[model samples]
Target chain A: MVFSKEVKSVRTQTWIGIMSVASLVAIAGIFLKVAMSTQPREENYENITKPGYAIRRKYFWALLIVSVVCLVISVISFPYPAIMEAKITGEPVVVKATGFQFGWELDKDVLPVGKPVRFDVTAKDVNHGFGIYYHGKDGSLKKGIFVAQTQAMPDYINKLYVTFKDPGVYRIWCLEYCGAAHHIMTYEFRVE
Target chain B: MDVADRSMYERRVSGIALGYGAITLVLFGVTVFFGVIMRTSQGEFISVRPDVLYEFMTLHSIGAGGSLMAGVMAVMWYTLRKHLDMSMNIMQVVFGIIGAAVVTIVAVTLLGYYGTGWTFLYPLPFKSAGAWYDFAPGMWLLALMCVIFAFAMSWIDVIRAASKKYGFSNAMGWTLISGTAKPENVPPPVVLISTVTAACGLLSLVAGFIVVSLMLIHWANPSYYLDYLFIKNLIYYFGHIVMNMIMYMCAAIVYELMPIYANRPWKSNKIVAISWNSAFVAVTLAYWHHLLQDFPQPLIFQFLGVFGSYMAAFPATVVTITGTLILIYKSGMKWKVAPLYMYLGLMGWAIGGFWAVMDAGFNQAVHNTMYVPSHFHTYLLVGAAFIFVGGLYHITEELGGCRDTFEDKLGLWTWFVGGYGFVLWFMISGVLGTPRRYAVQMPGTEIYSTAAVYFAWTVVFGLLIAIARYLTRLQSVKPLRG
Candidate 1:
């Protein structure tokens, strides 16, 4: 019965405590190794190509060290309960939406037949999955991910880079489940 | 083993079933385990190679699903047999077993080509596994046949139990049944609701069979006109109902057992009827929520699906919470292992329900992510499995007359704590942006370190809990004499 006055045996309690302590030590050791391996600036190597990534990297490491020290003092079961942002850098590019259609003017849509035009895609309110529909030789919408993953941005700007290597009209559509009228949210551009 | 008694015979049969289920679950678990490792490694220091991660990711989703289908179907077979008044038809049961065996054999033999997730979306199955992955039609056909046999057996049992207890006309004639029922009392509501859910399951199975056949036909010949979208719609229709069937089985167990703990036998007949009717209405309409993700489902369908989702969660929530309250205050309680199992089982179901509803509500940002898996895993593994285990234990005790020893008590505690803890931990990892199918978390992400720790802990806890329970159950007793 649940109310029975049975208590944990002292030996078992001690054993449990011992195991917990050992696990705690292992956890701490790993945390330290991760911290020491990546110097602050080096962590932002992925965003190196983006604007101001180098400078942001420096500050990011400093914040991390400070956070880790705070973590040690607070010493809860988990390490860093809040998400520690790995410093990223990019400027938002706004595009106009007309009714159920979205459009971007990149100064002359015509290019060589085999040339690739990469479009920076983002959404305004909720998450948007951008799928580019380029027609193949057979004329069906050749499906591919302009941005396969739903890139989350609070202010509705996501930079999606896609290359169009074939000449034809390619339609851009948001794949993420936005709100009502998502299906009609489409745009088209032609490659020469 | 020693000279085999009936219990031993039962044990051997159950053991083989358990072993098959366990290996399947473990394989599924291991695939997920490796996935966790890979997903964490990416943005974190732990990043494993992408190629390695991809291999596991591809296997993990599809593989785990295959195992789940096998395990749940197998467990249902055992439970369905026990619940029936008369023994089930041997031929049907054998057919179910062999059908499952063939599915498993085909699945394992062609593991190399089994990616494309369990949905086996048309072109993906063909594109990925080519002819070998094309074995899905066979898998689905077996599933449909298995469902028919399972349902027929279940229907026979329920109809017989209901007719024997309450005359068929009276059982349907009563508008409602009120107050709680005793443990053994087969309430018209419980019988009716379970039957309806089983019916829905049969419909879903048939739908799935039809869709999978078309998909196979499409695969056999790459036709430009093949509507993959329609096939997907049908698959989701069936796919969505199967989980509800599992939930209904657990609910049936809850309805049956809660009174035993509360000592409040059936009183009002009307309330029972209403509850059954409400469940029948809610469960049938609830298949729409599964289509809410990524798919281009209509807004009308989405709204209806969400409504059904909330409706489905509401009734069980009331029953379970009300039952728990009655057990707590109304009855001068005995806190034995069996009751503990039931109480904890209720808690698991309730917790699962809480997360399920929370995750369903679109307002909650957390619901959209991998955290959803955390919710479902809590429901399926703890909510469903815990109740199933408790029901099994009840039979092992009351029917088999097996008493709990100190070690058995330890086994119970280990299961309760280890399971709940592991799930909580797994959820934390999920919340940390550990992608569900990936072998590792995206590297250099903030959640990587914490997710890894939690994952590793879950694996440890799961192994310990599972092994301890396995050993405890291994301790046997004299069989039930006729």
Candidate 2:
């Protein structure tokens, strides 16, 4: 299967940047306006205080409402096991992943495309991160283009769920700093 | 106290503040140099051994954190001394402890090659894979303990003095909450903020002590096992709170000095009181955001992480940022270096804070990536660091009669432009899914790292110019009498 590389998450990240830039530009404008208007004038504290308080009241409410809305949206889309289970149609494939000092070991190397897969990741020593990177038609893992990740720590298994839409190689890189040669801690698998 | 006694006291405090400021400046310079090296190495501009790169990473974390903490604490101590009867002896001892700890940290990282990064995590230190000497981790932990101890001592004195003067409730602006505040009874914004930060700092230090002690015990005996998740929680709690307190300390400085520039009084109101009081609780809870990637962690706590993170922005945005804009609007405030840096600092705080809250909401996309460092660098370097630099300039001008020259303004603008440029690339890299703490950049990510190197150098050049100007002014110092 040939899949478009522009995934939903990438679009979401682009929106994050756009929104942040828009907000930042507006804020900078306000500061600049205030900064340039340096006319020598004195105003009564009492007069400013009353209106300031009223504005603050409204501002606080606006912030509260926006925050609550964001919180609701984020929680609904959170990548927990229960939420992941609800999104899939059939029983999910289970893969066990164990991370050691500079490498990863996955019990299942080939996963079915268009099917949900659960990665039960654990670490033998120290803590590592189980991060998956998608390699499209090229079949080579590109640096800095991760799709999903979760922590891999000793004595604990962290479950990460994903459905590969493309039949190609996916690479696993350690996201957490796990001592020497952490950058070389990479593993690869395929979906068919 | 008689006039002579008061004059002597003021001078003594001034001297100590300057001493701390000078030490902090040195730390900032060295740590920033280390940072430039790390970034350049990642960009492949220079070759550094992997072990050496990690060592620099460890030192940069501790050093940058220490510099900011010291700078803001100096500002707070200086500002609070006028209102409260804090002991100078305790501050002197803190200065000594910090100096010694810096030496120990450098020795351990350089000679012992202790490259476990700053958090040391849990077992990473013990499982160094023959990368470092056996004694390095224990020594590094002890050194950090000393630094925490020094900070704890300072907080104790601040709390003790404030409590003695205004009572604990009044110090925290609780009296304002009940509408029973008398003119003389209400603490200034600085005092209120400092008290809250100190209380929280003390609690975090206690957590630090517990976690460090546990690590030490485990290090001493291989038979004694530890829970990885539990230790991780405690570490983030302690580390995150300490960093937040340092930012709050910068706010305390701004609360005191921004008013002076605007020629208006920022008195403690009921709203101000409510915002900070809530912040005390919210800051601690917000540490959960750091653990959002730990899947086995409880789901409720993850929600709390998002909630706490958003709530943490409320006080800053609704109160401090808004109040600052109102105060300066048409107030004919002078755009001197002090207020200029401060104003930009507040802007950085607001911008950086917006991204921070966004990151909290969308943790899965950006966590542990360059985006993490990008957001923090925005607030820490451009926000908190700018505020401290502004405060230092204000203090020196007032006491030592240091005047802002043309070079000062030039340096300030250079720093402002370069600082933003440096962080912008980090943010972009993060968006591209580049993981942080990598000694060598993954092939494609090296492009962003390479771009960041030039910007980082610009910041260093700006800083050097500013430091030169500041040192020249120090020669003509004459302490002002009360």
Cα lDDT of model 2 by residue, B46-103, tens digit: 9898888999999998899888898789888999988999899999999899899999
* DockQ of candidate 2 against the true complex: 0.71
Residues A43-141, candidate 2: write the lDDT tens digits. Answer: 776666677778878989999999999989878868888677788888889999999998999999999988889999999999998888777645754
Q: Provide per-model DockQ scores.
A: 0.02, 0.71
**What C-alpha lDDT does candidate 1 achieve relative to the native structure?**
0.46
- What is candidate 1's lDDT per residue for A80-130, written digit by digit as tens? 101111121232222332221122234344434433233344333334444
Best by lDDT: 2
Task: Give the alpha carbon lDDT tens digit for every residue of B57-150 in model 1.
Answer: 4455444444444444444444444444433344236445544744553453346434334444444444431323456444544444454454
Interface RMSD of each: 23.5, 1.5
lDDT of 1 at B188: 36
**First chain of candidate 1, TM-score:** 0.36
| Model 2, residue pairs in steric clash | none
Off by over 4 Å in 1: A1-192, B1-84, B90-99, B102-110, B129-190, B266-268, B293-296, B328-330, B363-368, B406-412, B415-418, B425-435, B444-475, B480-482
- In terms of lDDT, the poorest run of 10 residues in model 2 chain B is B473-482
